[model samples]
Target: MDKDWIAYSECVWQCRSNNESSHQTIGSSQAFSVNMASMNEPASTTASTTHQSQTEARTTSSMPNITQHSLDHNPDIFTIICCNDSFQIALDHSTIATLLRVCKRVRPLLSSKVPRFHSWWRNVGLWRPNGSLRFALTPSEQIALSLHCEYEGIADRSWLDNQADQGNATALFFLAWIHQIDLDSQQSVNKPKREAICQQIIFYLEKAAQADHPMAQYDLAGCYRNGLGVDQDPTKAVDMFRSLAECGIPQAQVALGGCYENGEGVDQDYDTAIEWYSKAADQGSEDGRLHIVFLRGWFSFIGHGVEQSDADAFNRWHEVSTNSTNPVLKPIATHMVGWMHYLGRGTVQDKPKGVNIIRENRSDEFPLGESESLAANWADINSDSPALRKFLGMCQFGSDHEWLCKHLVAVCLIHGFGTRQDQEKAAGIFEQLANEGHSVSQLWIGRCYSFGKGVSKNDEKAFEWWSKSANQGNSYGQWMVGCCYYSEYGVTRDHTEATEWFRKSAELGNRYGQNMLGDCYKNGCGVTKDIDTAVFWLRKAAEQGFENAIYKLRQLDQWL
Candidate 1:
């Protein structure tokens, strides 16, 4: 074998070993055997020397090459390498370097030949005895091998035979985990293959994590974070993230930082976000870079948690805008770039570019149809307005306006617009809005209770709140109270009293009150019936889609 290939092979071999000493010892004997055996095969075929034999040899020789071409297309490279590494570590006590070397050689071999055997080979290599690695592993190593085989999604009968040969506590634990994950006692949804795999992973992960494996700690954190085969708890997730972060894992550092920034199972602290981001950033994390930029820009702009410096803020954003290789960072950078252009802050004046960037980032979001139209309409209403803030708030609430469909859903419930006159639903929404101190919502809630439009009737509660709103000069509340007395909903029936209230509401030119008064005169409910007066008020309310007035107007003269 040439010196360079041998050296490369040796390094690869080391990755599969438990330690440096093991690599040197293992490589000394097996390195040349593999190189010589593979090299001699070509010459041996050529020496066969008969036309028929030569043709047969050529076809068989080309078989590996054909398989190699096919294996190159399988896209999941990283996952395979990781699986191989995990097996080697568990079985032979091989280090990552040795595993990498084995993978480099075996991947091409498996890729060119029968790629289907990659998982099987990995499991075997993981459990293989140190000295007799080419054949079989020790009893304990075999159990780890079996668990790993199941974890990698293998289901061949031969694979089961291999597992039974090494099955032990480790294998049993892995099986239990696989069962727990894939088999739900309450549901028959678990597929046999996935159930078996889940049982194995859970069992092993629990055992290994308890034994202080960094990978297990990281995985446990993820399990808690997502409630994967376990209860989800952000606090437990943070704890796990912290433990793993202490061990210097980049992903754990990022996760821990997220907990600190959002106050999820931790205190909200920008300083901590900055601190954790820095730690992860030092390890070349793309996410860390993006977060650093965001935190620095936000803190610098507001002069909170970090020192004030617009130049520094823009510089941080500009750095991420230019430097990061992460795909997720691209959209975030585009968003911040758009903001900079829109505000003409630190960056060159370029609204068109900013808009383009925003649109580009928007491409990743849900397809906007009528929601875009609503946004455009909303924008046209106030060009120099803070509409972006409202839109962003909606996004935060998980209701992006992707459809642009105009929905008076909230208003419809309030005024019995579409489905049904639901005062209970209306009151609930009013309460929601009123809690935000929106005067319109507060007034509507009072009216809903007072009239029992879709809710049970309440008089004292309505009157007390209405009086407060009236004192605040709420015109709608004033009109609503007047209409209540006029209709005699919760009060004693009295036409004179009703008229007095109607006149007060009418002076405010409340169209609803006008329509009500018109009803009174037309029906002689409070005053003498008068068609002319009814026509006047009905025309006013019809313009607002008031159905009552429209019906009344058709009777007047067909002038509606």
Candidate 2:
């Protein structure tokens, strides 16, 4: 039997037959057959009558005998046959090639094996002969069907290397996995060969996993589960995850449980996916943990995977909510907890605590370590230092800091951080820094003038300083500049310009900008009337505690 035909035939049989053993026997080659039949389904249908009218193309090569063993060893035969039934139901509406392409995994293999008679290699970066993906295959017919497995394997390796170089961790992981699978080869590798490829796969997986690649974690777990390349130590794989688990990798935690739950490389004990799911849940990997919860619950409810205990599943799900670090799941867990309390699952029904938990878990506070610390230190050191004391007199005497820091030192004299307090020195420093085009210092100086923090009140001077900072994309300066434009303070009134600055600030997630943007939208000042957009902006600002925005949102909602 032709290998391709046998694979395809197996797919057909697999789809129709419900034999479990028969299905498992149909191996990798079956995937190819299913792919070919799928791809050509629609074409075959549209040209059904014509297909038969035209005689089958004759070839001089001897036909291979179809055998039961061949059909029994491929996934393609089963899947293809299943698709055949589906195609018959909608034959006129679908194209065979289109259907075949749906099975993405088998498409390339099928394409490689097809006999190409009149094809050209022109395209790059894509499959198909005219497209990229050059395979070393010969054409016995119109399609290129004589591809060598070694050539494909080399291509796979190259593809994986390219993906890794491009920093696509997921692709890198899958490519390594494909290498491990080695579907094209029939013989089991010698110990040396197997170890070499497996070692390469482990290297690729390690690189990807360190880069927080999800698929890499999943496959790495599988490797640990099966003891492929490394020693069959599930505990080592689980131990590989201190960093990943803490860094919020959900899949890693799931894999880590294998060691704990089965005691494969650790101690065997049933944890029911609860402990791992809790860790994953906290990292916003609720989807992954949800699968665990479902299985655990199903089993406990009737003991499918574990001993029967409806209470155990219920309690596990509760933990999935309260202990989860994922904010999205917090709300779902909150609701579940509320329902559980209402129904008296375990704890007394406490609606208020559940509500509070949901509110608290909506969004985790991002750490203000590097950026905030830098900004604050810069603020403090610049405002303090004894060197600023000597400079203050010189600054007042029309002398200035040789550099921006000198000016900041003078401001420090006025601010009394390291020098005797003197507003005059501070004002002088502000003048120097603002004139030097230091955006942050300019905004600060503008703020001082606007609020009369250290200088005589001056709106015009404030606007000038704000304008300079706004030009450099300072968020606060942009906000003030927008205010100036909108209020026509020391400038021409232009809502369009106000809106422009507002949009710039809003893009940076500034609450003040969000508020102004909502106002602009509401009044049709600089933008077209957009009630929805206005509401959205207002809500964002309100969430950030912008009082005016909150008031406006409430009024607008009432109107709606």
Candidate 3:
């Protein structure tokens, strides 16, 4: 009923009006002004309360006090499980409160049956501890959440202030989250506007964290960790991580594990570090598993509380590279293993084998979206995307897998992927790897010799390289060798030899080989013609969506 509340409302409207460029609702202040220009209430006044009584309440009682139910839903566990994180992070605003005001917690039958120990409430806004959130939108919060300042749901400063006054921890965090969203980096800001925004965030985060809001506490730890709003205190950061870690938060567990490993706040305790990492790893935390494995490798040679041995270190890193499927960690570990092998520090000196280890590790994504039977091509990778830049950098360094790096560089040269296209350089690189007995490179060099792509077209040289790769069990190479034998490109036409090579490739699941073998059978080039057998082989290739196989099947009038 006091003028202070009215004065505050006016101030908020004035501020909102000034911030029109921020894309907030333009004239909401004027509309709200007429309805709430009086002494006490805006629209939420005494006159609106006595209209109806709930079945659970006395007829004389105003509105039934509903138990705290939340419309503020957040993501689950850790997306660092990635819905698991991506989906939850995308769930910032919007609610089902519009369609039905009946929230899950408001359903008396459900509420009594199951206890909702939701962690999402701590991250989002509005809890049952005020109004009901229907299955659709707006216990008023749906309105606040689903809109910007454009509609009734907009959580402008005044709305959040009111919710915060009502002891809404989520509201407090939201006020902070939305304000500093633009300046997401927690560095000390120089501009007055940014400084003010940072200060606002600190104010709300501190208040909400004090109220024991889980998200607020999580962010508060970040502040200390980054020295943003609070003075940098490794001890405080450690304390916060320890608290959340105990609550079964995987991110907190990893953070605490890192702190222990690095001696950030406590003495170096590798055992304790491993313990926290194991806990997080149990919850499927990749960082936790990675740290545990990395720690073993780090101290294996350093003699930090463990017996130092070069071989032991190499084994530890090799285990990581061989066992892990993580895209980032696996390559790093594999590189470490290759380097150790090359240096002859941990294992026997075998430079070619060391290079070969990296060479074989790139079966997956070697061509990286090039569609020509897993070979490199003219797919556009020239954009300054982060992934492309990182990939190009990795290829340039050649630190972890030298031969693998050369192969990728050759691919880049051929396709101009994040670099200049140079057919000659690519052909040279392929020839080098082919001499090193790299099967894929042997196949590529064969193609280069056959097509004169940076090299003289020579069927004999192409047939020679293809034979080498085919001997090493490259399926595509077998098909190429078969082609050379059938076409008499480098030697006399030998149908039996061509048919045998095609059979070998077909058995290894090469669609081209299957199609060719079927054709050989159909024409009796190397064996007696058998229409049924030819149909079987052609159908197999056709099932894999090979275009040539489908055409052959159509020519034979076979079911495809």
Q: Please give the CA lDDT of all the candidate structures.
A: 0.49, 0.51, 0.60
Best by TM-score: 3
Give me the displacement of residue 364 in model 1, in angstroms.
7.0
**lDDT of candidate 3 vs native?**
0.60
Q: Please, what are the lDDT tens digits per residue for candidate 3 over residues 447-489?
A: 8888888899998998999999999887778998999999998
- Candidate 3 or 1, higher TM-score: 3
Over 4 Å off, model 2: 1-422, 451-453, 558-560
Model 2 gets an lDDT of: 0.51
Tens-place lDDT per residue, model 1, 225-245, is 756656778799998888667
In the range 1-560, model 2's lDDT, one tens digit per residue, is 35665565554344334222322576423322222232223221123433322212221122222233354577666446433433233211112232232233323333433323112212111234444233221111112112211233133345335546766544455456556556225266687877788788898887766544444655676676557666665666666543345444565565565345445566654463467757776755655566466435334534455565546756765776656554333333444344344334456655334333333432212111111111111232333222233223222322331333354454445446435666665666667777877675687677667767668888898899988988886665788899999999768999999999998887766667888999999889989989899988888778766689988977876333
Write down the worst ten-residue block by lDDT for model 2: 368-377
- TM-scores for all predictions: 0.39, 0.28, 0.43
* Candidate with best lDDT: 3
lDDT at position 170, candidate 3 = 54
True-structure Cα RMSD, model 2 = 26.7
Task: Tell me how far the alpha carbon of residue 540 in candidate 1 is from the true structure, in angstroms, after superposition.
Answer: 43
Arranged by lDDT, best first: 3, 2, 1
